[model samples]
Target: MSRLVKCENGHFYDADKYAKCPNCSRGAGPKKDVVMEGGISTDLDDVKTVAMNIRGNIKSGRSVRIPKVSGRTIKPSNEILDREEQRMRELQEKIRDHKDSLEEQVTLAKESYEIDNDKTVAVHVFENGIEPVVGWLVCVNGEEKGRDYRLIRGRNRIGRDSGMDVTIRKDQKVTREEHCSVVYDEKSNLTFLVPGNGTLTYYKGEMLRQPQQLCSGDAVEIGETKFIFISFCEGERVWKNEEE
Candidate 1:
């Protein structure tokens, strides 16, 4: 865009070429007999400016133009109006999408950390013993995704109950507690999925009737949620006391 400026005195000048309005800085002068758009003078009357250079000021090399007074408001062209409406609609849609994303993040944070007995307070880890985290149960399919429950050195009970060690609270079909068991044997350094009080725990598309050894990528299904088991205390990497 042209960086030209029009002073209140109707003088058009390149602002980049001067600090202040050059015409206004020149001080006041007697009113010119003619008012042209690109004409530079302090006494230039209240003439409306257009996009063309005045014929009389051709020698000045500026492309500023002023139109004779018509005393009418110029309405924007139809193309300009349409473009403005489209821009407003797009902006509104972007704002709506951003609001929805923020709401989802806030909801997830509350469910993961809030101290309510009904929701999850899984954010804090209180260690009464030196039990090391031996594995992880990450929910791969459910109302929530990418949420991981820690598996400690001993039995990590799985259920929807807040009191459960490996809680999957979003799935209603899960039992309140003891939906299943994910156990880490410290002596043998192996992890196993043990059937709980629930009707059945599904592992590898079959009902688990007995304790089945779990591997790093084994799928376990209890109620409506699916989890991918990952063992950290296997392959000679078992956790032990520092002094031991």
Candidate 2:
């Protein structure tokens, strides 16, 4: 009983005495082994050879011409490469623009927060009975050394006694009480340095005879104690204190 067999060339034959298809041509039949000079036997029918003279070209130091494959060896054109580069550049630009937009939004948010903070501070100042600190007297020489006395809208008495507003204990030259007074008039919105009847008080390197209108950055000396007046009410109208 012979069975049907398919050859490499796609021919079907009866596998009765022959291993290959007898109906096919000899070239399309089974491969024959051929022995080379190196005693290597290879099937000549299965071996593939190039039609061009590759060995001769390689020996002459010439570049071998390789047959290009349909899709593998074909390189992209300069125009296609340029298009890809342009697309990459456009993507980077979009990223930079997005980053800048985020930064701008952050800046705007910070500015809004600062404005709100200022408004809240202003509201707190107006709502409470807290008098806005008009100025401060920084002690230049005294036992209460390096301390600052807040000058508000009222009579600020300075003397050696602790009962006074600003006491000068280190200076024996200061009187027991009421050596001088710094008065702030709410109606006139002006400050005055009024020296006590016989109290030794100097202002701006000159002896203050009567009540002198005080301003920002004024140097006042009561006995041996010295003080510098600093004002916070800047850019506002300052009225003159009329002597009665």
What 10-residue stretch in candidate 1 is worst by lDDT? 117-126
TM-score of each: 0.47, 0.42
lDDT of 2 by residue, 184-231 (tens): 655566777876633578999898655677888899888877788887
Per-candidate clashes, comma-separated: 1, 0
Predicted structure 2, TM vs. truth: 0.42
98, model 1: CA deviation in Å? 56
- Alpha-carbon error at 155 in model 1, in Å? 0.5
Off by over 4 Å in 1: 1-131
In terms of lDDT, model 1 sits at 0.66
230 Cα displacement, candidate 2 (Å) = 0.8
Question: RMSD in angstroms, all models?
Answer: 17.9, 26.3
List clashing residue pairs in candidate 2.
none
